[model samples]
Target: MSQTRFRARTRIVFSLLALSVMAAPAAAQTIVSTYTPLDLENCRHTAGKAEEDSGVWRCAGFGGIPVHVTANDMRMYVSYGGNAKNEPAARETLASFHGEGTSIEWRSERAANGKLKPFATILRFRTSVADGDKTVPGQVLVVTRLAPGPVCRVGYVDGRANPDANALARKIADERARNFRCGTDKAVVEGATGPGFSPPAE
Candidate 1:
């Protein structure tokens, strides 16, 4: 080939390669899972009004975040942050007539500063399914987002219906938690839902 023709071809090839490199997708961020135990039995309780019949507990959360759990009537509500500004409203409740488990699974990502930033949490709630005249045990996994205004529930998985409830919960957290909008966005419920497995009225 002629010298000029070869030089022109080489320039075009290099330009194409450079453009391709620029258009390539960046590496995805790494996400991780860490666990923190919730001990309602051991946490300090804060007294509320008699009519409310509420018991509140402040528990240790991953990465210095504070977990606030409140039990009112027969239902439980959870919030996370450093103070009241980052917590959910007093009327917020994740489930109806359900009790929560003692363990909390925190889904976080490592920041550039080598700190863990928690984005979501997974907690199990015990519900009841009516059978005959008695009630049988049922479980629901609640996935809650940690930020974007007063951490709120992002999704729920029916443990009895989904064999991989934990995996689904984590998937929901990783996919939806960071961008989930509290109050405005509705929490998603996956798998078969009935009676105690259904989403809360709130």
Candidate 2:
């Protein structure tokens, strides 16, 4: 009964996930990208010698598109397995990300409420296609709410920035929530292709 109830509520929440992607600025970005869903259920990516977790997910490596994107995963194994002991430790370890540009960038921003929640810790890595430029531009933000497993809920903003920087950030955040697919459906950005390319997912 509890499992059923959990499934029901989760379904309701994610129903908004797909719609959010479409309800964005009329003149905003046109995603010209293609992707394949990475199934983390295989367990091969999660296994290791120690309790620590490590894995990687490649989205565009299959040559479906010129844009290649990959994410390398990381987790810390607690020598002591208790919440209280780890809360402070997590806080200390998840410090402010003080870098920017190239592949990855970290920033400090005041979130909702006067208090801060470490804003965003962006990590990005990708292998570009032969037709693609190595200096491709993209941005990402992820919140890995570690339950029994690392069930990560990620948000990202792609493409280059325009003159208005603040507008760019807000547009990215809006697109992030819109592009979010909470359950099994992998979130996709349609029309992210180069030249006359268009994603079938769109």
In lDDT terms, how accurate is model 1?
0.78
Model 1, 133: alpha-carbon shift in Å?
Answer: 3.3
Residues 1-202, model 1: lDDT tens digits: 9999999999999999998777664324567789988987777789767766677788888877888887777778787887633465334654446787889999998777768888899998898656678776778898888864567788999878888889999999999989988878888887666555746645
TM-scores of the candidates are: 0.77, 0.27
Separate clash counts for every candidate: 0, 8
Evaluate residue 153 in candidate 2 and report its C-alpha lDDT on the 0 to 100 scale: 29
Q: Which digits, one per residue and each the tens of the lDDT, describe model 2 over residues 15-89? A: 888667667553243322222333334212323344432322222211221111212223221111123123311
Model 1 bad stretches (over 4 Å): 1-29, 84-86, 130-132, 194-196
Lowest summed lDDT across 10 adjacent residues in model 2 is found at: 91-100
